[model samples]
Target chain A: MLALGVAFSYTAGWLAPSRLSAQRIVDALQQNAGWHPGYRRNHAKGVCVSGYFESNGAAAAYSVARVFAQGRTPVIGRLAIPGGNPAAPDDSSPVRSLALRFDLPGGEQWRTGMNNMPVFVVATPQAFYEQLLAARPDPATHKPDPARLAAFFAAHPETGPFLAWAKTTRPSASFATQSYYGLDAFYFIDAAGRKHPVRWRVAPETADHTDAPAGPPSKDDLTDDLDRRLAQGPLRWHLLVTLGAPEDPTNDATRVWPAERPTIDAGTLVIEHAQDQASGPCRDVNYDPTVLPHGIAISDDPLLAARASAYADSYRRRTGEEAHVPGSAPAADATKASQP
Target chain B: MNTHPAFHPLARVLHWTMAVLILAMLFIGVGMVSTVSSKHTWLLAIHKPLGIAILVLAIIRLGVRLRFRAPPLPADMPASMQWVAHASHWVLYALMFAMPLIGWAMLSAGGYPVTILHGWPLPPLVPAHGALFGWLRLAHGVLAYVFFLAILGHMGAALYHGLIRRDDVLPSMSFPRREPSPPQMSDAPATTQASAVGTALPEQPPEAQPAGDPASPGQGDAG
Candidate 1:
């Protein structure tokens, strides 16, 4: 009894809270790129959009999730550039994001925050955190210290391909024309409990894909462009899920599967309207990448958990500041106001 | 019940306040983990500061508990029951301190800020280390279940004393009444003399005796 008592006490003493580390990443982001109140720590500049995801039932065999059962699932989404400053010029960052929350049947929901990049910049959460630290602006120069960035690049060779891609790729003329990739791999659990590792991307259906003109960009270039497009008609994107082979890396998001892999056109995403984030339906949403329905599950990709944690922390900080800010409440008004 | 001595006023206040805070913390903790909705953000914001509040209260509560003597258990109560009561009380106190401290440390290891209010963040308790964070996260999850079980057991025991046993144990820590004190009979001597002669004498039932009289030093530390 005494031995058991001691063991019990020791075990009890070890209990701590989970996901406590997310705040540090947010803090690092704030340190790197100044804090913006009532805005996401990253991807602070964005436009909110409401739409519907019409599933074609092709993905039903891969997952038992009801969202894939050939139906229209209402979606609220946000499109944004990768930056901490909400007022940052759209041309400043090469990476763009498309985050969606699908309101499924039976009140179930699936949320995913995807980016335009084909793969993530880092392999692990630690590396990502370190990258944030390395990219922190020097106090004297107001720019990332070249020495620190060089040191980081030398240490992580895997970042070379992403850096090369970012350097060469031109920004898309509009958010509606860019393909958004879910860099992290996930498991689609079938009805038989079989797990199929897959990566997904939303390909734009618009035929007028073009690069932005070479000139100084407006601060609201992306949002304004999206607004103009929405004024004409609803924008559409096809959801494509790529099946991975057994040898494909599931844990490292930096690695990509073979281009020859089979791809499934799971559904079509129709974004009907766009509005300013402050008064938009998607303003209050947290598109955590891990918020999967019953048929979908997160894989061993470390970035997924890191993204979920950081998104949660970012969500908490912004919402806490929401009450102090005006014109940032009640999505209903914004929905009606943005309707054409 | 009127004869039973009430718990120290400060202890009672702390007990009740901590009770409410703890219950709220448990619910908030559960909600924060289960959902990734927009509501999760505010839940977490409330959780961080609330945890720190519980930590601060637990320290003060522990100090208050140690400084004042608790009322003695009824002499007729079984020895096993007395031991269980004392042991469980200590366990509750242990958990009250452990949960918040571990949470703070886990956050520190994870390199996260331990913000209490909106803008004020506490200093980290440990240096950032990923391995330490993983271990601490597991420990925190396991302990949460244990803490929940302990809370249920404590509530069950409290109800048993209040309803089933109908003993003075429950009332001892309850809100005090405004009744005048009994005569200055030096109730300490009477208690010592009765226990010395043995509780088996059957002349008076244990409930009939003055429960609040200055208890013997050893028995006064029942919890």
Candidate 2:
């Protein structure tokens, strides 16, 4: 019976603390990181861009989603540094993120938020909450104590793999050269009535540029590099869909599937231009992964649903702040309304 | 039904094959729900393919059983015992069929594909829906408990017949009884070997008394 209780404590999401909701988790994260007013919630420092996704028609064989029908669809994307600080230096952060929205016909949109890291740190939302609490800064020092962090690792040994991954993964030179992974699995139903669980990753067409920087890195290093690259020509990435094997852990994003699994090169994503986040298409949009197209569905991974709720909470908090930030939200809306 | 001394060879083979498979499946099922270990990923891999195999084999067993007539119960046995023997066999068969289908449907409703190989896809048997998945999962879990209890009862009854009653019922489905010639002569005298062979082939036209009598000379061969 004690063993069963421990099993439920680690695996079952429903048995988590009743007071802990998506809003509460996000609020706790923001508080621990020291909240920055008038900034987007998690990935606060970001650049938005407009692009086109050209499907190779191969994705249609796996999913009947209209967006994968071998044509170019307008896409709004955002590149960001992970954390809640809007003014965090780009060179200081190792993990970067990209949120994409593929706007199909009939207002049907497929939105996904991905990070450069291959997997998430924790398997369950409750554990993630505990992680936030562990890393919370001391009231006097205003920084997390090393002792608290050590105790956290001791209690939750499952987090060791993610920490090792974070330590080993090198920072990318530019967002265009980084491969962003969708950490959760999604179900893709083909026309033949077969549903397969799949996870997606945007693999940069350009070779990795992980060599040491030529000069001292600045606060806007990534953004400057992205601008320089887009001026020369359109930047491209291949959206690869990997089929999950039965042995692959579908419910846990903290664990990754083996690299030997087969992957389909679904399509090419072409970035046309990069713009400031406050006045770009990605500002008003919330990249909720659960808002999928007809043929694509969310897998039973608990983290997927938790992520959707967290994104919703983040979206609500940011939008509610629009009244105070006159230059941020309304300006983007005005510019969009004036465009074709 | 009274003529055949033991079960058909095909029936016996299916019974033992299913026994091992079902026992393995039960352990895998218990292991899956008991913990949140990384090994569960591999356990799930073994479970889906094994369940499908059991489903396919159970259908064949049902067909083989329907085609062949089962041997009669001991003539001296009570009617209630006979009724229980008949009813429990049907229930066991029903559970063997129902368990796999429920598992398949639960996975389908949850929008998870039941694939064996990396590229080989087992098509969804039901549409993806959250509420249906919840209900199907609950039904699958409840049936698992019922199936476990039924297996215990089945094993208990088999032991009662084999050890306490010293009857042919247990051996009928076992390996030693299905051979063409009786091996009872190893222990019994050569003259009684003919009687042992006769008891083994009670399939003589409707003379149920001589063949199924538990107290006959062949009873010595049972031990």
Candidate 3:
């Protein structure tokens, strides 16, 4: 029976205990190829399983960065027309909308999916209602009238920053292939757990390009790119997290965080698997700024404040209830407020 | 009158097992995030297999759902709510399957081995050092949070039906019935990103100190 136990354990990859034995496994896995029969890399350094080098989406066991901070997770995201128009071409618009959802660790969640625009076309819910209404195409023309956009522009001057990005940043059908913004005043903790407000952006390994397809692009381009890219290689993103002191105006997100401050190496991201954009993950996920990681709390951005309410409403609209996520354990919360 | 037969026996088994595993997974997730890298020696050893277990169980549960039909909703439930319930349940199912797969995919993208029980390393599903891990991680973080909200509503609704409304919803999914009307996938819903968002070991807040402003939007550090 004991012999059977050892054999079963061996077959199951369970190695016997002993500092040396474990080390030997680590050493073997770490070997040029690795130590244990197949697992650890007995590399030059030995069986060092550093998160930085060898991540498994379980970074939560170490630090909080929603992406890596938890156990294995599944996700889905949706791209759609921002206006009431369900058929809006992906191209005719400057801003794109992404609805995202994550199933994470410890039953705690922070869900909020937003748009390409840092700030919304309007701040107040009332104003947003108006924007949604005005975004309608002219009855006479039955097409999206420039007048509607002009009026929305005239109504919400705060839309200036995002509008600037829209005007400056070229829109591509391959948006999933483009950079995505947290677009709010987001806080990120460094290795030491200190907080900094950042406007996070994901720079795609595959740069956005529309040179190939002629005519303004089509909304389907983003989908085309996603499929094409998935077939081709892995999708990579660089997580550039910005830092700012509390009350810093740049943290407002109405204005950009100055180019001067340095964004710590919070992490890198790679996505090998992807689901259909029209899937439930994208539709149900909420990217509200209010759902930021600890150490990375919300800034006093008005956009974020509106987002707090709007996103919850959005989730309810889709899911039929107020989101009551059993929030992840607070990160250094007492350590922050009490320490000061 | 078979008043409590909405969930199948197989569903019940998968559901309870998943519940225990999921809750344990969530707690383990919390513990994992709170720990620092240098200090997290043992907690991590558990995270891998547990995650692998979730993945396997989710696959099995999905297969069962596909192979066996889920008992229909109570006859009197609202059509829209029924649709919503179906949609939510499937979304949860999709997430369950994807999260663990993403973990494995991430490792494959990073060129790392995702061994089951530290045994035979699964062949790389994708290539090594592929950029997908980064985007997959982002997508994973984004969706995990949303699922958290979904679970909250699910639990609250079950409690509402079970308590306030005094409906049989709770018992149907709860115990002592032996009716096997358990949630097919079990309520093993947890958040990977939630803990990451909350329990990040505080880093030294970089004092507005400028270091060449690569921090500008669109201008990332070029390696």
Q: Which candidate's lDDT is highest?
A: 1
CA lDDT, candidate 2, residue A179: 91
**DockQ per candidate:** 0.04, 0.01, 0.02
Report the candidate with higher lDDT, 1 versus 2. 1
Candidate 3 regions exceeding 4 Å error are: A1-75, A79-81, A97-104, A112-130, A143-152, A189-194, A209-212, A215-219, A245-247, A277-280, A320-340, B1-223
Comparing to the true complex, what docking class would candidate 3 get?
A: incorrect
Compared to the true structure, candidate 3 yields what TM-score?
Answer: 0.42
Candidate 2 residues lying further than 4 Å off, grouped into runs, are A1-18, A324-340, B1-223
Candidate 1 lDDT, A30-148, residue by residue in tens: 66667566788898889899999999999999999888999999998999988787888788878989999887765456888899988889998788878887887776777787998
In model 1, the Cα lDDT at residue A187 comes to 92
Interface RMSD after interface superposition, each candidate:
15.9, 13.2, 19.7
Candidate 3 chain A lDDT trough over 10 residues, lowest sum: A42-51
lDDT of 3 by residue, A119-208 (tens): 544443345445544544444555445777688778778668767776775555554555556666655554577655566554556665
lDDT per residue as tens, model 1, B52-108: 899899888666655665666555456576556556666676678888888898777
Global lDDT scores for all candidate models: 0.71, 0.69, 0.45
Weakest lDDT window of 10 consecutive positions for candidate 1 chain A: A331-340
- Tens-digit per-residue lDDT, A1-340, candidate 2: 2443354334423345444566556766677655554566678899998899999898899898888999988998999998777888887678899999997765466889999888887878778778777877676776677898888878887787778977887666688888999988888989997888899999998787554457777788889989998999989999999998877878888888898999999899998899998877677667777667777877777776666667645654565455342222332222121110
